[model samples]
Target: MKKSYCPIDTFINVIKGKRKSTIILHLFQGNKRYNELVKLIPDISERMMSKQLKELETDNLINREVFPEVPPRVEYSLTDLGKEIHPYLKGMFKGGIIFENKIDSEEN
Candidate 1:
């Protein structure tokens, strides 16, 4: 990840991608196989999911483990850094709800 003048920028840069934060939040629940993630985030295309996973792995926020079997099985789990960031993400989630509610009220 590139250094930013503000730490928030760095944080945003790491998590910025289509459904990247969502992917992290899901993996925070437990280790998941690729297909499981695909199912959990049906809105995201398989190709985009793959790309986000690769980027997350590269950022050291998540671990990708591949088992050697007839057909390779891969699972994703949050790394220490990923786990550490959960509180911040949780805050964001709560803040988002507040904003969403405001928007809904305005639309009515």
Candidate 2:
């Protein structure tokens, strides 16, 4: 199917959305259960968080594991592609601050 987006644009779109980048950031630190992510990014609604996670999984950036247990255990971690892509996350990490603070600005 011909997409209405450039290949690069399509690639960026997969990661640029509601909260996909933030969720990936949390996972980059280490593997986490779904609840841990919710706690880390409190502003995100549960529905939104789940949706973002699924998108990342589809993009091959994350791996979701489900364990069969009485309480139903589930965990999420980054895939090899995630490690490759994490460097880009830094752009989001240091966004405004990178240019917002002037080199000569002196503020305590």
Candidate 3:
């Protein structure tokens, strides 16, 4: 947990899992319902989504809030620590898009 330790590896340990990083990145914008995340990442199965969300929550990268109502509701959003990753995530996404586009163009 200390920055003096192997912080980069620790960070990667939390972020590098499949669907985990993307879920956190998407949550950087705002709170999202479980259904919303599934809709956005349609290729992911419901079971996988639930698993990823649980992992992120365990890592303290996300908040899992449940509301009381006739029909219960749950929403997820980035924790403050997770919000701190926003700038980096944005840079990664922007650069990844450009890189992918270049590869596509080269292949054609």
Candidate 4:
């Protein structure tokens, strides 16, 4: 991530990819496998999901563990930094809901 004078910009830059925040929030629940993430976030294409996961891992926001078997199994979980950011993300989630409601009311 690029250095920024504004801390918020740094935060945004780290989580600034398609469904990146969504992936972090889901992983906050618990560890998830690749297929489970796909199911959880059906709107994201498999290619995009892979890209986002790699980026998150690079940013140290999530952990990717691979288990060897007949077929390799990969799981994702939040790292300490990822967990630390959850409250901020939840605040943003709440703020989004408030804005959505305001928009709906304005349209009505």
TM-score against truth, every candidate: 0.97, 0.81, 0.85, 0.97
| Model 2 agreement with the true structure over 1-108: per-residue lDDT tens digits | 124468867667778868787888888999999999999999989999898888889888999999999899899999998878788787757874765675437553
- Per-candidate Cα lDDT values, in order, are 0.93, 0.83, 0.84, 0.95
Report the C-alpha lDDT of model 4 over 1-108, residue by residue, as the tens digit.
Answer: 678899999999999889999999999999999999999999999999999999999999999999988689999999999999999999999999999999999999
Residues 1-108, model 3: lDDT tens digits: 323358777776677766777888889878999999999888889998998888888878899999997688999999998899777767878999999999999999
Residue 49 accuracy (lDDT) in model 1: 93
Q: Which stretches of candidate 2 lie over 4 Å from their true place?
A: 1-7, 99-108
Ranking 1 against 2 by lDDT, winner: 1
Instruction: Name the top lDDT candidate.
Output: 4
lDDT of 1 by residue, 1-108 (tens): 788999999999999999888888998999999999999999999999999999999999999999999799999999999999988988888999999999999999
Candidate 3 ranges beyond 4 A from true positions: 1-6
Instruction: Give model 4's TM-score versus the native structure.
Output: 0.97
Q: By lDDT, highest first, what's the ranking?
A: 4, 1, 3, 2
Please provide the root mean square deviation of candidate 3 (C-alpha atoms, Å): 2.4
Clashing pairs in 2: none
Overall local distance difference test of candidate 2: 0.83
